[model samples]
Target: LLSDGRAQGYVLNDDIFVFLGRGKIAGLPVMVWILILTAVAVHILLKYTDIGRNLYAIGGNDTAARLAGININKYLIAVYALIGTVA
Candidate 1:
């Protein structure tokens, strides 16, 4: 959109759409702030959450994880749903 200017025709080429446009929060781009905040949140979740631990265990070994009483099928479905939503 920025490179071709096609978004301008639809009135969507404003500051929000343009990566270099003027709109900063605390001297950082809004997109950068969003990315930073998302990363921090994910880090915290993975570090301190039960689901996060379960996810790690599943990644290390599915058979062991299942044997250890983790619901492999449910977690796998949840993971796929999360991935689909994110993508």
Candidate 2:
């Protein structure tokens, strides 16, 4: 709705150019750092969190996860939303 049904994207201004183009830190581009940070965050979320355990359980068996009191619908929705965001 915010987009009003038209295409929406970055403005590609100086800040955008710097972040994705020539910007660097410690000899690595800013985008690289962003990717690394994102990866680490995801690792923590999927390795050390109760949500992660629930996700694994859901993956192994949705019915069992539901029986174990996990809200499979909410988890599945969140998982799909995350995947869509990444895509």
Candidate 3:
């Protein structure tokens, strides 16, 4: 998106603490929607995707997954790189 200049206004300008404290539920403030959406998406992906299965297999045992033709190292590195970028 950035490469094509499509993310120009897709920026989070608010402070984290303000967003956290200002977010609300019924009669109380909280940041639950983000967590709930994340949980649902993870559940759906893990239960219904091959990539999720491959990830679980790699996590269980890299050597066994490799013997079964799973590219454990590539997935691990990709996951790490994603985390690095997000951080």
Candidate 4:
């Protein structure tokens, strides 16, 4: 759709459509690799990083997270942007 949702919709190029729909690595589909890679990366980030701790803290209590030196607004904005991009 257009920016204001005034148009019908968007379309992907045929080459790109076929490339992603049919491309494989070693016998696995491209999407499978993408999913696995994203899952692993997110798991590592959320389970083993200070940013993850701050994010959790923010989720629990914004005031406490802020007092603890976690920039709640930054993380909240970043999370929303990431989600919007993915969606």
TM-score against truth, every candidate? 0.70, 0.74, 0.61, 0.70
- Model 4, which residues run further than 4 Å from truth? 1-16
**What local distance difference test score does each model get?**
0.83, 0.90, 0.77, 0.83
The most accurate candidate by lDDT is 2
How many residue pairs collide in each prediction?
0, 0, 0, 0
Report the alpha-carbon TM-score of model 3 versus the true structure: 0.61
Candidate 3 stretches with Cα past 4 Å from truth are 1-21, 25-30, 82-87
In candidate 2, where is summed lDDT lowest over 10 consecutive residues? Answer: 10-19
> Which ten residues in a row are the worst by lDDT in model 1?
5-14
User: Residues 16-82, candidate 2, lDDT per residue (tens digit)?
Assistant: 6766777889999988898898889889999999999999999999999999999999989998999
**lDDT order of candidates, top first:** 2, 4, 1, 3
Candidate 1 lDDT over 1-87, as tens digits, reads: 566855444565676566545568888987778778778887887789999999999999999999999999998999899778755
Ranking 2 against 4 by lDDT, winner: 2
Candidate 4 accuracy as lDDT: 0.83
Please list the residue runs of candidate 1 whose C-alpha ends up more than 4 Å from where it truly belongs after superposition: 1-9, 13-22
> In model 2, which regions exceed 4 Å deviation?
1-12
The Cα error of candidate 2 at residue 57, in Å, is 0.4
